[model samples]
Target: MLTTTTSKINIQVRRFTIFDIENLYTYLTHLSPETKKRFGPHKFDKQSIFDFYRESDKNIGYITLDNENHSIIGYFIIKRGFLAHDRERLEGYRLTLDNQTDCTFAPSLADHWQGSGVGKLVFQFILSDLKKMKFSRIILWGGVQSDNTRAVNYYINLGFKTLGQFSHNGNNLDMIYSIDQSTGKTDGGFDQ
Candidate 1:
């Protein structure tokens, strides 16, 4: 678990639980339309929530919450080689799939929490967890929309390289991040 305080309000990072479904659902349900657009393709279906709860070789979820309120402020998922469209594009990069280290990353934060430095915090926390898990690669889920410059830029700023482009549900940019395990090195361009 990771805990941080912003102006005295504590925020924490932790794995999801069966009981968290309601809070997670509430957060997804309350996501602004604009938030959905950038992060869309992500839906609030309760079944999807259950699927995440299942946690298998295919999908996993993580979350950040205000410790006092227990409200989800950030949510992220990593899915295995399930998106056929993603696998086809990733194969071009020669990424080894169907393993522990290779997966797709999809993260979304509450609208108000975005651009407020919460993202970097969550990422730092997640990256460390990934390192401990010995993961070496992470891909953007569904690819990123060609037009969402902020999200694209955010990924790039974090050391992700644009791998290619494909039109699945829309024009998306396939990107990848390769981690150097021995040294725990990354772009680390953003401050911790």
Candidate 2:
């Protein structure tokens, strides 16, 4: 879904399919330990990967690749519905989001690819794709860690607003990104 080239890197965002196991394995295993931690410790082997997307209707991930070599370098995972973990946190703040219109996302890039201007391109594509799907609200999956300042700042700059904090297995800050569907504008507030 990436529409423009950045830093001479042609990135393409494509929905994951069962055929992409090998590519996904290569991408996941090549990531440094820190990157993997940030992305979560999900099984990426053949069988697990296949089972993971079996219910593709509810959960989908976009694989972003450097089109030059056609290798996956990042991911944007979107899970439809108010994920149970997220629901509890939002409720703590007295905010109950709509499951039908809201979805949670976890966007991550390979260590070397991060902060290289490709993230903006990836997010641009993601926003357009989600808008087409008629998603009214977006929230970060699992919430942002209290100490992860870089990620916290990144989300804030991209129009995510903090609803409050909740201790859900860890200290996490609930964030919401609201979109004005009629005008296609995101009016999510930011921390000042």
TM-score of each: 0.84, 0.86
The best candidate by lDDT is: 1
Q: RMSD in angstroms, candidate 1?
A: 3.4
| Candidate 2: tens digits of C-alpha lDDT, residues 153-179 | 778888899988877557888788886
Count of steric clashes across candidates, in order: 0, 0
Question: Candidate 1, overall lDDT?
Answer: 0.75
Worst 10 residues of 1 by lDDT: 183-192
Please state the error at residue 175 of candidate 2 in Å: 1.2
The list of candidate 1 runs beyond 4 A from truth reads 6-9, 40-42, 55-57, 94-98, 184-192
Error of 2 at 154 (Å): 1.6
lDDT of all predictions, in order shown?
0.75, 0.74
